[model samples]
Target: MYQEITHSFTSKKSLLRTIQNDNIVYYWFSLLFLNKSLRATLSQNKNTALSYKEFIASLYFRFILVFFLALFASAMLFHVFSDIYWAVLLPVIALYLSAQKKGFKAFCNIFEEFINQNFDSDSLQKKTLYQIGEFYGDRYAIHSLVDTLQRNIKTYTYFFGISFVFLVFIYPINTLVTCLGLLTTVLIIRIYFNTFSLLRHLQNNK
Candidate 1:
């Protein structure tokens, strides 16, 4: 009777664990796919007026999201599966690949739109500094800077919070690596943007 009770308890625990894992998987997929759908919708809206910072933020988010998604799918394919599980993963892999390809194309389209909107010298120059000053007085640049800062803070908070949770629960060593990688990425991006800005400034002077 003791053995029977112990066996029953173990089975119950296993079932609960399976249910919890399923819930987690469901939640993750829902969130990922929902974001993908929303991004797709936004990408289709070519008339959407986004500031330069917002455009950059959208591109950054999409790039990071796609990178992690692809990484997760690859890990599942190569590390998490046994030979027998390949059959189960085949459909998922196909779906993921298809979605990834479509997502990248959508991202490109949105990026192209942003470039056309922001880089067209004729249209951009039409809104001259004098016109901007008349319209927004002296506060335009300050407002833009404040908005960008707030957005950056929110992005940092979200990224750090998620990273912290994963670090504490799953990968403490990887968290350090991720932080270093993130810092490197930020520095590289900053340098790229600074260079781009310098080039634009020179062009405007000419």
Candidate 2:
């Protein structure tokens, strides 16, 4: 009886870990696919389209490298301070900020290069407008596709964000981080919806 119970507990633990890992992968994949800059990077090479798998792998590798580095730093902090609050909280905030900074930097660099290369700003803007108009035209069911993409984006974002928030509660030192993280997640969701709303408004006016 004792052996059976232990085996059942171990099996359940393994299953939960598998589910968590799978959710993390799904969230990360959705993030890469939804991000405009990452998508643009894939299209950078006209002669040969960059392999999407490789691109995602490269970025994920960078993220994991940084994440582990942060963990090491957190461990060192805990060792020295002997306090969970300062050690864990500081590293957690630093990790979040570092990720945001790196991502934004990449986006800015790519967007700047794209603008500089396209010297004819007027033509570029006109072409973009034309494409947008066509996308929202009634000829096809593109809106359905857009709606589905937006829905999935929101769903994945919430799944990951809420999971993180739940994790924050597990660690007693995560009070401030949890509140701020939750707020940021809400802001991100709002921005995504707002972008879609703006696009639809343009479609209506056009």
Q: Could you give candidate 2's per-residue lDDT for residues 1-206 as a string of tens digits? A: 11211222122224234323433322322343334543554456542133444433334544454455456657766675445545566665576456544543443333334334433444444443223223323333334323344465667576666757575755545668777766766655543332333333334433
Candidate 1 lDDT over 8-114, as tens digits, reads 21222242343234322222212221243334544356553232224434334444444554556576777754544556556554654554345434433444453
Question: lDDT of each model, Cα atoms only?
Answer: 0.40, 0.43
Q: Which 10 consecutive residues of model 1 have the lowest summed lDDT?
A: 1-10
Residue pairs whose backbone atoms clash in candidate 2 = none
Leading candidate by lDDT: 2
Deviation from native of the Cα of residue 5 in model 1, angstroms: 64
**Candidate that scores best on TM-score:** 2
TM-score for each predicted model, relative to the true structure = 0.26, 0.34
Q: Give per-residue lDDT, candidate 2, residue 49.
A: 35
